[model samples]
Target: MRLLRLPEVMYLTALSRSNLYRKIQAGTFPAAARTGSNSVAWVEEEVLAWIQARIDERGLPDTP
Candidate 1:
């Protein structure tokens, strides 16, 4: 149930700040939880699952 800060999320996802926000806006990425008025963090498990999903997608075979 750990929450990851923006920097940590960026590092783990290898996404720039702008791109991350863009994905979030597009509903393609996990949403962050508001920790404070000026602070937000993502759930660690959600981020990890997103990464794993990407990996799984990449490992799938292409179909005609």
Candidate 2:
């Protein structure tokens, strides 16, 4: 149950800060957990699952 900071998440997901926040707001990405008064982190497993889901979606056939 590791928590990943913003930099780590950006590196792993290849997303910029704004884009990440946008996805979060859109509910397409996992929300961050508040770690402190001015700190927040994401659950490692949840981020990984989101990535895996994207991969799975890519592998699915497009329906007309």
Candidate 3:
């Protein structure tokens, strides 16, 4: 039930911020939960799941 901030998401997904935002806009990724007026975070499990899906689709190696 952990939550990840932007840097965690970027590191975990190997995505640039703009790419991440693009995927969000395309409905291809999970939206972050709003934590405050200027804060948001993604569920860790969901981020992991999304990474898994990408790996599965691209036949990429697992993250260490």
Higher-TM-score candidate among 1 and 3? 1
The digit string of per-residue lDDT tens for model 1 on 4-35 reads 99999999999999999999999999999999
Q: What's the best-to-worst order under lDDT?
A: 2, 1, 3
- Flag regions of model 1 displaced more than 4 Å: 60-64
**Better model by lDDT, 1 or 2?**
2
What does candidate 1 score on TM?
0.90
* Candidate 3 local lDDT, residue 23: 97
User: Which residue pairs does candidate 1 place in steric collision?
Assistant: none
Order candidates by TM-score, high to low.
Answer: 2, 1, 3
Report the Cα lDDT for residue 48, model 1.
99
Residues 1-64 of candidate 3: C-alpha lDDT, one tens digit per residue: 8999999999999999999999999999999999999999999999999988877998767789
> How well does candidate 1 score on lDDT at residue 60?
81
Per residue, candidate 2 scores C-alpha lDDT tens digits across 1-64 of 9999999999999999999999999999999999999999999999999998988878787668
Q: Name the weakest run of 10 consecutive residues (lDDT summed) in model 3.
A: 54-63
Candidate 2 positional error at 9, Å: 0.2
